[model samples]
Target: MATTTKDRLIEATAELFRHQGYSATGVKEIVDAARAPFGSMYHFFPGGKEELGAATIRWSGAMYGELIEIFYADTSDPVAATRQFFEAAADTVRDTDYTDACPIATVALEVASTSDPLRRATADVFESWLVQLDAHFARNGLTKTQARSLSVSLFCLLEGAFLLARATREHRHIRAAGRTAAAAVRDALEHRASTVARRR
Candidate 1:
């Protein structure tokens, strides 16, 4: 299917936000990158850039979450799935020349202190991803609380690794972080299994 004008605008904004961030990226630049008309932005988003920013954050978040689901879906072993997910993330950074990582982290940091709506938008996205991850972990034998905690830990690890990787232009940080995360998942799963066996 052909991409619509609104889709182009959102995609362009998401790309710009991923690289330079929110305040630094202008509306004109987004339209230009999207090859969308000026009026179309307001037409699609009456609240203007703020609205678009929130939408882009949510949209990108949903897409990224779906990508995570795909990774987990491809493997039944949670540890392998976690390792594969982080390895792929590292590859993505290298492939994009370190220009792209998490689509909303830069914007989230920039507007977190200033914009209430945008901050909420970022929070919502993170929460959604966490919920999805927790579900996946739970399916793999973790209790709800353990799964949620592990999901948060993995998210923190990935975000921190993304920052370090981009700053140093090195994939070592990402690889190390991935290893740590995969180990954490493996350890948690093993512990849970042992407890279940003891109960049985």
Candidate 2:
């Protein structure tokens, strides 16, 4: 399916933001990448780069969230789902030559201190991802607190792994994080089961 010019602009900026970051990615570069007219960006986003950046952050965020749902949809086993996600992410990094990880992270790190709107966009996006993962774990057996905690743990692990993987040009960190994450999920489930049994 062909994308509209606006979609192309957003998606192009998203990729550039993932690789080069928000500030480094120029409006011309974005238009060139999108194959969009320079004027069209304003037509779609009058607030210019910041507006586009925020929108792209959100679009990318929702896309990542849906990916988790897709992985979870195939299995009820939280361990398998967790493993699948990290492994796939590692594969993607390798495929892209370690240039990409979370699409929002690059921009988030850059604009967090300088741009309030972009910072909030990133925070909201991160929270959205956390919420989705929390729900996934909760449905699998963990209580709300446990699920939320695990979600945060997995998020930190993945983000850290991505940083290391990019720095070293190796995917092992991601896989390692995946192993620890799966174990944590198992521990959470077992703890829940044990607590439930004790109460019985």
Candidate 3:
């Protein structure tokens, strides 16, 4: 299928944002990377860079969340699924020379205080991820609140691990963080099971 110009622009902006950040990536760079016409950016996004940035955030976020769903879909055990997801992420970082991680993290941090629209875009993306993770945990025997809290914790672990791993150029941080997240999920599932048994 032929990719549309707008899609290419969004993808290019996302890639730039992943490697650099919102402030560092220019419209020209995006168009060049995307092989898109210069004026197409404004034509598709009248609000200019800010609008494009927000759209890129949402687009990248959805793509990442869908990836999580695909990774977890085949594995019924939530703990195993969690470990697999983190391990895969670590491998990807190492393979890509640490150039790839969460596509929105860089932009999210850069725009958190400076731009309201971008901040909201990041928040919405994070919330969507949390919702997906929460659903997976709940399906695996966790209470709604427990699932949501664990999802948040796991996300924090992954994001922080990505930063640490990239800085050190080592995979140990990713492995360690994955272990901790997997342990947390395991404990939650066990605790829920025990509680149910105790009530019976």
Candidate 4:
């Protein structure tokens, strides 16, 4: 399928936003990178950059959320899959020279206080991710409470590790965080399994 002009704009914007953040990336740069006409930005996004920013956030957020599904779906051993997922994240950061990490975290931090609309967009993306993670854990035998809590913890761990890893230019932070998260996941699963056994 050919990339539509609208898709190109979103993809280009997402790429720029992921690397340099929303404020640093200019409209010209977005168009140049996208190979899109200057007028197309307004034509596709009538409200301009802020509108485009929100769209990028939602699009990138959904794309990352799909990655979670790829990792954890239809698995007999979600715990192991969780470990592999984090390790792969570490690998990606390293491979990208630390420029590529979470798609929305940078913008979320940037616009959290300044832009109410952007802030809400980020919040929505985050909750969507949590929903996917929570469902994955819940299906793997964790109780609802346990799944939600673990979902938040794992989310926090990854985001924090990505921040640190990018700052230090060290991918090891993500790798170590992955190890720690895998342990937490394993512990939760084991505890849940034991409790259910006791009930049985």
Question: Which candidate tops TM-score?
Answer: 3
Please provide, for model 2 over 1-200, each residue's C-alpha lDDT reduced to its tens digit, 9 standing for 90 to 100. 57999999999999999998987999999999999999999999999999999999999999998898898765779888889889999999999999879888888889889999999999999999889888888887788999999999999999999999998999988999999999988899899999999999
- What is the C-alpha lDDT profile of model 4 across 166-193, one tens digit per residue? 9999999998999899999999999998
Task: Name the lDDT value of residue 46 in candidate 4.
Answer: 96
- The global C-alpha lDDT for each of the candidates, from Candidate 1 onward, is 0.94, 0.92, 0.93, 0.94
For model 3, what is the alpha-carbon lDDT of residue 170?
92
lDDT of 1 by residue, 40-121 (tens): 9999999999999999999999999899989886577989989998999999999999988999999999999999999999
For model 1 the local lDDT of residue 82 reads 91
List where candidate 4 sits over 4 angstroms from the true fold: none
lDDT of 3 by residue, 1-200 (tens): 59999999999999999999999998899999999888989999999999999999999999999999987776789888899999999999999999898899988898999999999999999999999998888888888999999999999999999999988999779999999999999999999999999999
Of candidate 1, the 10-residue stretch with the lowest lDDT total is 69-78
RMSD of 3: 0.9
The true-versus-predicted C-alpha distance at residue 31 of model 1, in Å, is: 1.2
Candidate 2 vs candidate 3: the TM-score winner is: 3
Candidate number achieving the greatest lDDT relative to the actual structure: 1
lDDT of 1: 0.94
> In candidate 4, what residue range of length 10 has the lowest lDDT sum?
73-82
lDDT of 2 at 190: 93
Of the candidates numbered 2 and 3, which has the greater lDDT value?
A: 3
